[model samples]
Target: MWSGDELDLDAYLARIGRPGGSGAAGELRPDLRTLYAVHRAHTAAITFESLDVLLGRPVALDVKSIEDKLVHGRRGGYCYEQNSLLAAALERIGFEVSGRGARNRTRGDSLLAVTHAVLVVTVEGEPWLCDAGFGYQGPREPVPLGRPGAEVQQGEWTYRVRKEEDGILVLCLLRGGVWRDLYAFSPQRYHPVDYVLLNHYSSTHPGSSFIGRVVVHLPGDGVRRALVGRELTLLHPDGLAERRVVGPDELLAVLDREFALRLPERDAAELVRMYPAGD
Candidate 1:
């Protein structure tokens, strides 16, 4: 179970720009409206990045470590940290939250390992797929799990969950009139320990996509952007993607401006030093 009691709920809420008080805290009830609001605010405020992994630092899954780095420190994180923090917040709000390990399906025809971490939140006895960590292509709000193959529109983006023949639920996105598979997850409940193991492989394994790379993504209503290595790609709802190369001199600025991320002076220098060597 997520350590909701251990999390500083107010701090987490404030970090996402939703201050927890009589005004806002009163609205943080365990319901669909609060779930959608929190999920949207989180994805809008915190970016998706693998800077710690690229810096060779251990990505801790604990609520404290994640709160320190992401909430207090004003830094971003990958799936585990993002969804873990979210799950903790929702759980603290008296919502039913669970974990699910998902396999990345956007890669190709080859099946990949179960590395992605997502959350399942139950509201009024109905489960909703609440993911704030799928990068630029992720959902901004909770996608209802009760209705499969139903189009759920979050702003201009369209997403749907299809039930495969094997009972697996695959999340798909509509891009340029095509339904592209984003990732697939099973109903098997994952725990914090499971994420710790998945985090190890993703942060250390040679085959990991995040290793030796500068990966950052920001999801938006009009445009979704991702910075992979030196190339920066902007994706639109119509499936039009524009790519451009980012020079080393502009790296930090791009992260700050585009992703709303600014590292410390020391970390900035180190990331700049390692930027040229990235893939």
Candidate 2:
């Protein structure tokens, strides 16, 4: 279980910009509308980033730590932190939430480890894929798990879930008229301890992509932006992407202006010091 009781539900709801008492006499029902609203609000408000990993800090999965860093501190986090906080909030709202480990398919055809953490929330006996992480290319709202290969439109972005022959469910996006796989996961369930183990490798291991560089993503309604190392890419709904290099001097500004993320002074200075200058 995700320790929902330990989370500050009111604080979290406010952090995501969801007005209190909006759901029928000040109670959040565990229904599809609530699921969609909470999921959308979360992805819209919180960004996806791996700064703590790049800063040599531990990424804690506990709900309190997650709430402090993300909800209260107004900072962004990677999959483990983002989804864990979201799972806790949803669970606190009386939704049936579970965790799943997913493989990164956008990198290439090579077999990758199951390192990504996602959540499955059951609303009225129907399972929905509620992922608040996965960067800019991820789905903004909850995707229906019961219906695979059906297109779900979220603003300008379009996404679908395809069930593979091996019983794996792959989340795909329609980009530039082509179906692109974002990530895939089996039906196997994961737990908080499992994420803690995965987070250790991602935050410390040299083989981890987030170890040596800065990566941040903001999946806006119209424009999805991703900053990897010094390269900044903006993805449009029509499948057009614009790329540019963000200089070290402008890194913090871009993060604040574009992603709405402002790190602590010490952490920001350290990030600039560790930022890669050469290609």
Candidate 3:
């Protein structure tokens, strides 16, 4: 596990509301519980998207590089980078987190090998599914693999987990009385290089959705995004809100008011350009 001083530790712990990870205060022991809590908190706070793609960044995989952009630089990233950072923090907080590659489940399931990075956490002799990298349909808690009776619902979304042949873990969402394929994976360990191919495809390929727009994903019971200045839309559990933040200053103001996140001057200009104003 990665051990660090108080600054990173305090920031990470405060994010999970478990100071020093735990002290016999929460529902369960700090070990597994801390992992789940942090997973939820991180996903709730940090979104997974190529905002850096909109900002003209060369999204790198190394935690130090990612930390410089996200932790130190006040920026956000997509799955490969975001999940990697969260995994590092989990390791630092004394959880046994192993990286696992997966695929997007929405739309038609991709034929590609497990090309995206998720995680499997072995907690208390059980493998728990944990991911903070998915922007939309994501697990708000660590899921017990093969536990049919176990389910979770937060806001307007619900999730269910099952184990299949060869111990591969399957996760799906309960949608319209149908099982929606979100993603599936096995507990096999993962490496950083496993995601590099995905990173390359998502970043450079013209057909990849990440390159085509400016995506600002802030997930809660609500989510909002302004896709390349075309329109701004927000999805809440109850309803939806849409608008257009036309110029740089107006976009900054909207960012401040809506998300309470301030953007750097240079980034502000790039945001407006990435999502150029519409007449």
Candidate 4:
């Protein structure tokens, strides 16, 4: 059950500067602390990048390697990496974290590609659905379970869950009280193979948008992304700003000036060469 008990908790805590197994005494619910640890562990550890795609490596699912990247290499991982680690941590902390399956809403997106994850936790005799792997756009708090259409607020994104016909679990976000599609899921529960097949399509497959651009979502802050030769866009709480760039320099500038992420001179030239559009 603990896939990452092998992962060094001390190292993970040190990497994030949160007390890992540290002393404290208060009304802190262990399960709730488990959730908070996972959130901090995930955000401070993983990142959003196409480095794996560019490097032609299949996404890996080992704890040691994940820890290497999270604690040392300054890398981020996708859902399975982040959530699996969370599951391991919860299991270690004596909380039950089960793996669940979710679907992306995009038309024609492979159910396999759409497959996502969530965790079910029982806190003080009440079950709660917890997910911290949906980076950038994630819930700041755990959504209560045993109820339909319950809302949980992270910071900016407000999320709600609905269970529909045939046991289909729909988890969504509220924008103006209307449910907006974030993803729908089933409690069928997935294993390693389920994730393995899904990860393949997410990183490959020419039709997958993940491969067509650089997507760096900074969560409640919104998204920063660039499509090859098409556009570079940034979203804000109030509005959106976008532009078309001639090449990499402009794109790098956007990343720097807009998102405050600095791209090295060589890396900027490289991405531009890879995604040149009309002159």
Computed on alpha carbons, the lDDT of every model, listed in order, comes to: 0.94, 0.90, 0.64, 0.59
Ranking by lDDT: 1, 2, 3, 4
The list of candidate 3 runs beyond 4 A from truth reads 1-7, 14-30, 109-113, 164-167, 222-231, 236-250
**Which window of ten consecutive residues has the lowest lDDT sum in model 2?**
18-27
Q: Candidate 3's residue-wise lDDT over 157-257, tens digit each?
A: 66777667887666887655666777878667777776777788878877676776766556565453433444455644333455554555477676666
Q: Write the per-residue lDDT of candidate 2 for residues 141-255, one digit (tens) a residue.
A: 9999999988999999999999997789999999999999999999999999999999998899889989889899999789999999899999998899999999888999999
Candidate 2 regions exceeding 4 Å error are: 20-26
Looking at model 2, the pairs that clash are none
Mark the 10 consecutive residues where model 4 has the least summed lDDT: 20-29
Mind giving the per-residue lDDT tens digits that candidate 4 earns over 129-228? 7675665445545677677776666655567778888887766765544556667776676765676677677778786556756654334324423333
lDDT score for residue 172 of model 1: 98
Task: Show model 1 residue runs off by greater than 4 Å.
Answer: 277-279
lDDT of candidate 1 over 17-135, digit per residue (tens): 98766566656799998999999999999999999989999999999999999999999999999999999999988899999999999978989999999999999999999999999
Question: What pairs collide in candidate 4?
Answer: 46-76, 47-76, 136-219, 140-154
